[model samples]
Target: MDRRFANGTVNAAQTGSGPPLVLMHSLLSDRASFDRIVPTLSESFRVVVPELPGFGQSEAVSGGLAAVADRMAGAVDDLADGEDVIVLGNGYGGFVALQMAIRHPNIATRLVLADCGAAFSEPGREAFRAMAAASAAKGLAAITDVAMRRLFAPEFQQAHPDLMRDRREAFLKTDPGVFRAACEALAGLDLRPQLGQVKVPVLVVVGEYDEATPPPMSHELAAGLPQARLKIIAGCAHVPQLQAPQAFLSAVGDFLGRR
Candidate 1:
């Protein structure tokens, strides 16, 4: 089930057998972030969960997010084999998927952007710059808690101690250089102008309690896209698929199930 594409620059796990559905993980997380929902989704689609460039077994890419997006577009194209595929991205992955769709207009037939936005507010940009600086100066350890807080609310973290531990371990495995580079790219990123280029339908979903990207960001993303609908998963933060898998699935079911 493990496969390499784009000349082994991309690594992914494949399952099921039907229309292709690619799952891209967040910058703070790895491919495992989609573990909760993959099994069910695979039943209806050939699920391809890829580790974004510079994450897990995938090789890193330079030239900022656009370069990263282009690299992923190659991988998706290889996986799609001529047929259009569906791309679902979470958090940072959502940003990458959005850029990929923009740069490669025909790469995906539809998009599921979860907990991401076309542009971050000034304060949000400052946050990424701060994280990059802090991590570069002292390493990822210095901002581990901050990263975890952004991913999950304090209450949720407290309620799921074991899952928190697993998530923390996963975050620690991220390459520090890759983390800093992504942070810098996100800090300077603004994809709103390119939203018009994406002709595919998009399902923009966010957690009602998400603070990292927030609901307004998703609202703006949905409004900017040519064809997009917004959905808010109640009582969850970023990474709602991990926090509340059933609700997350319910939010995207209709869109994903459509022919």
Candidate 2:
């Protein structure tokens, strides 16, 4: 079922029972973002998929990356029962997960960052700014095409036309202001200098054809962290969990299961 902090700053979907495993969604996604893989993940651990502020049923909370991290850290604590837990984050969620590890050390016992990098390069920051500008000028409809292209490969887009339409509608429904604020946060974020502080084991997975955060970016992320390994899912784009579920599950399951 769903659980919300008394203050109402966080809302999460909790299931199963065992060592905690928290799954964080992408920027534009909700708790259901991990629905396809949750059953397998929950079989091994109590899985908590939290809908970050401004997404799904969760209410928006003010702040930048650090502030967002604090809210997510609180959710982690509420679910972990005082025990360190594994955190798996995709896209924007990955960014928040890194901030959690850096800002509130010891909260996460293991980290799996999917389709995300340590920091955005100059061009990447500009992309976020441009997206914010376009969205602000004409709402989410203006940027949905570009966002979709960046999130998926052309071949995949061509093959899954209906899914593309649904996702486009989903984007259009989100408040442009909230989406813009998130983009601005990404534009201003620079985590490269602090990667060394993340000592917990990390698994950095990137889609083979991710246009937004490419393999090179994931390589940079893996190289920066003190204890990190990289994995690339073939024939996949930005959303491996959706595009290559088996590969994604295998990578994450092996990492969490290994001694």
Candidate 3:
């Protein structure tokens, strides 16, 4: 279920059979977030969701995002066979996915980005900076639902009453120092210019009403990649996999089925 590498421990769930598919969840989430989509993806391929370092039961590292991202890349490299891997990342994890692809070019094959927050116009840096400042000022323990309002629309936040609270608590549990360093990594990251170098088939997914990453960012990812496809989920906010599971599965299935 889990292993300790030179970098950090990666808690992974490996099931089904076929090509190995690596899953990276969004910020404030762990590997378990993929529980809903795993069944669908496992039908066609082996699904491996690695709980990134410093999140959940995985190892906690003091390294910034780049270091953690690098460690994540190594973890995948260790598990991957000679064949390229199909990596699926949602929201902020998309940045780590991009880092993986960029750092481990040979192992990263096809990519599936769901409500990706990176790989586009990035004000992500400033947001991360604010988070760092907030953590420094009030400590990570005090952060609340108010912290996540930036990610979801006010109406969506109201409709899904418990989601923000749960996520806020989840993030708050993280080590303040590590969380702040991660924010530093996020603040320094900007992948828009490097999108052209990603030489793999890509599927860019977005929720029409997603306030976090939005449609324009998805379009940027699709437009930049050499061989990329775009799919927009209607009437959905961020986390379409959770918001509209069946539709999310269909879109992913169609894309993977093509290859």
Best by TM-score: 1
Candidate 3 lDDT, 101-190, residue by residue in tens: 766677577888888745334465666677789779988655544346545667777787786666666667666776777677776766
Candidate 3 local distance difference test against the native = 0.73
Candidate 3 deviant stretches above 4 angstroms: 1-8, 60-63, 117-124, 150-166
Write model 1 residue lDDT over 1-259, tens digit each, in one string.
9999999999999999899999999988889988999999988999999989999899999999999999999999999988869999999999999999999998999999999999999999999999999998998989999999999999999999999999999999999999999999999999999899999999999999998999999999999999999999999999999999999999999999933
User: Which of candidates 2 and 3 reaches a greater lDDT?
Assistant: 2
The per-residue C-alpha lDDT of model 1 at residue 91 equals 98
Off by over 4 Å in 2: none
Tens-digit per-residue lDDT, 1-259, candidate 2: 9888526678888898788888887876556657778888777788888888777777776888788888888878877888769999999999999999999889999999998887788999999999999888877877788988887887898998987787777767776777888899989988999999999999999999988888898999999999999999998888888777888998777888722
Index of the highest-lDDT prediction: 1
TM-score, model 2 to reference: 0.95
The estimated TM-scores of all candidates read: 0.98, 0.95, 0.85
RMSD of each: 1.0, 1.6, 2.8
Ranking by lDDT: 1, 2, 3
lDDT of 1 at 11: 96
